[model samples]
Target: MTTSPILVTGGTGTLGGHVVPLLRSCGHDVRILTRHPSTDGVDHVAGDLLTGEGVEAAVAGAATVLHLAGGPKRDDEATRTLVRAASRAGVRHLVYISVVGADRVPLAWMRTKLESERAVAESGIPWTALRAAQFHDLALTMVEKMAKLPVFPVPGGLRLQPVDSREVAARLAELTLGAPSGLVPDLVGPHLYDLAALARPYLRHSGRRRPMLPVRIPGKAGRAYRVGANLSPVGAGAEVGKRTWEEFLAERLG
Candidate 1:
């Protein structure tokens, strides 16, 4: 049987970088949607999700689409553009990468993600949405951003399961090859850690000595995190990622 090409939007980003290579290694044809029209290996199609430009051609011959493109600023119009384009292209399967607690999280970014997931489900295409915990790199980035401050004021007692980006990408590649199962298991790291604890190693690596002030954030989002809304349920069949926060810090800091 001829393996159908899988078009991965945001293919140059962290998760898509890992996902595209995995699909290629699995002998599936992989195509990447990028803003640049460069002719690199693994079919590259130039497209812009914001204006819905070049999307139809990007997904023309693909059977599966890993919809990973979204603005960090949470542009709902951009998301609807992509969804409409994907539907018009008649894409068979869509595998969306979402964050944990997106449905109930009070943040605007989380709410935009929830809206995008809903658009995919109602797009008349078989779809699978994989909600994963925050990426370990994102936590490291936060530490780097806050390193210069004398005191790190973090919301205390909030739980986070920071999974590796590579692990999430692997699962996405697998889903591209398998049948669509509406919403798959939430992927998380093997261990759960508090935000302050996760930032300590990062601080040490940067040679910064700062007191961590555990502050209670005043918001519904803070309450949700305190209740472990960012964790996978016991029966969710979550894939356990091997990389730990310590390991990630060691590699990144070294």
Candidate 2:
């Protein structure tokens, strides 16, 4: 009997870059649903999850779908589009990667993520969703921009638990290959750090010095962040990734 390929969205991205190889190494035939045509001759299907362009065809014949494609905007709409297509195609398992605090954080992006989670859960298809912390790469990007300024406005009361993307990919791959499970425990880094703690190390590594100006992130969002709404609850049985921010910096910048 021939096995259907596992269709992965955002397979060219950082998390997907790790996941696709992992799935392939485990002897699973993998396919990538991409917006652009493949120039590398891999098993890529041209499709757009937002517009539904070529999405139906891309979902065809694939028993499982790993949905990792998302952005700052229109993520809910895109997920709905994909859900409709996947449902029509009788996809058995749909795996999604989301951020921590999708339900608790009162932000536009978090709203979209929560909506996307609802779409998957209500789609009548077997599904799994994993909420993870911000990746070390994203943390690095944030600190990099802040270190470049003569005076960086450090948002007071803001903290993050940045996990390793590869660890996240490994977990997602496990969930993708297993039977459909509901919402799993959150995944976060080993420790939490304030924005200054994240940025100070970057400054030292890059041979630059900057004045840190502590600034409050006013309004409801600020209030949410001040209370650690973005972090996974302690003793809630959430999984922790092993890599630390310093280790990431040493490997990336050194």
Candidate 3:
């Protein structure tokens, strides 16, 4: 008997790019749901999570749905759309990728992440959600843009534990293949780096220097970040991914 394909949303993206291959290697048939169908040699299902178009059809006949599609906004709405369809289609497992500060950070995007998590849990389908730290790729992009400016304004008390996206994909692939485990340990990097610490390596790598201005991020969000609300607690047994910012920079810049 043939197994049903695992439906993956955002399979063309960075995280999904790493995950789909791992699943395929494990002998699982994978179907990728995307807005723009491509002939990239993977099974493609055209669908829009935000608009609910082709979503039901995408979930049809699939026993598992790995939801990685997200954006700066409307993530909660999109998750809800996917959850409803997945529930109706009797999807046995729904695995989601969320951020570490989804509940603690007082930010709009964080709120959306928390809401999305809730939707998955309450959808009645066996679900697994992993809250991961900022990806090194995103951190690199941020530092790259900041270095372009005349002066780099390092936010006061801002810190992050940037994990490797490939490591995250590996973990997600394990969760996707295993039985549902709700709200697993948060995945984070080995060490934490503040704003200046994150930028210095980039500057040295690129042979650029700029005046560093210390700026305070005023408001509840700033306070939350300063207090390390966005981090997994040190003694909380968070799953730490083995990769450093310097290692990432060396590989990326070299």
Candidate 4:
């Protein structure tokens, strides 16, 4: 079977790590855009998205561009640089992995994501933006961080549909293979839980019992989560992940 070369930015990340292998298994040639050029089965293109360094050669002749370069922290300039470079390189399709509630969230990080989505939309390239809910791993990380605090302050009454990172990666790879369909349905988990309630299991597993104080985060972002912006009840088809919060905690804690 003929294989098309697909360029994956942020190829070393958690989601990217899973995506790279999945694409290769499907008989697609994977070119990973990374700062360090490492020949680990897949082709590694050395580049930095912040300065638009080496992006031209990285994306050259690629059939699809999985734009997964943004950091959890905000950097508008860097994101804009990436969008411009991809557009200039004439990429066939751009698949952007964005976060859920980014559009309604007031947090700086979420706002930056929203802006990146906008840039992709206006770039004139065939693009598909997959907005996903909070990763199950991210929730675990939050629990660890909160454990260090004297009192864990979490968003009260906020319904979160935390999906597995692996599932999100699989969906992204499938989307990259096909044509861009601008703003695909948000991918959510099978169950919704309050932030504090979700952390309780992790806390018990870790043998650290701390006071869980739920607080209402006052802002548009907070409102979005409360109203289920992080969930995709109905739209595009969503794959239900089998791993639950308890399963995730047991594996991580053990």
Top-scoring candidate (lDDT): 3
Global lDDT scores for all candidate models:
0.82, 0.93, 0.95, 0.81
Q: Would you list the clashing residue pairs of candidate 1?
A: none
Per-candidate alpha-carbon RMSD to the true structure: 1.9, 1.1, 0.9, 2.3
Clashing pairs counted in every model: 0, 0, 0, 0
Output the better candidate (3/4) by lDDT: 3
Expressed as tens digits, the lDDT of each residue in 140-185 for candidate 4 is 8877887899998887657777888888999998998888899987
* TM per candidate: 0.92, 0.98, 0.98, 0.89
Candidate number achieving the greatest TM-score relative to the actual structure: 3
lDDT of 3 at 187: 99
CA shift of 44, model 4, Å: 1.3
Model 2: colliding residue pairs: none
lDDT score at residue 23, model 1, on the 0-100 scale: 84
lDDT string, candidate 1, 18-108, tens digits: 8878888877888888897566677888888887788888888778888887677654566677777778888889888888888876888
Q: Which residue runs of candidate 1 sit more than 4 Å off their true CA positions?
A: 1-3
Give the candidate order by descending lDDT: 3, 2, 1, 4
Off-target runs (Cα >4 Å) in candidate 3 are none
Better by TM-score, candidate 2 or 1: 2
Candidate 3 vs 4: which has more TM-score:
3
Alpha-carbon deviation at 244 in model 2, angstroms: 0.4
TM-score of candidate 1 relative to the true fold: 0.92
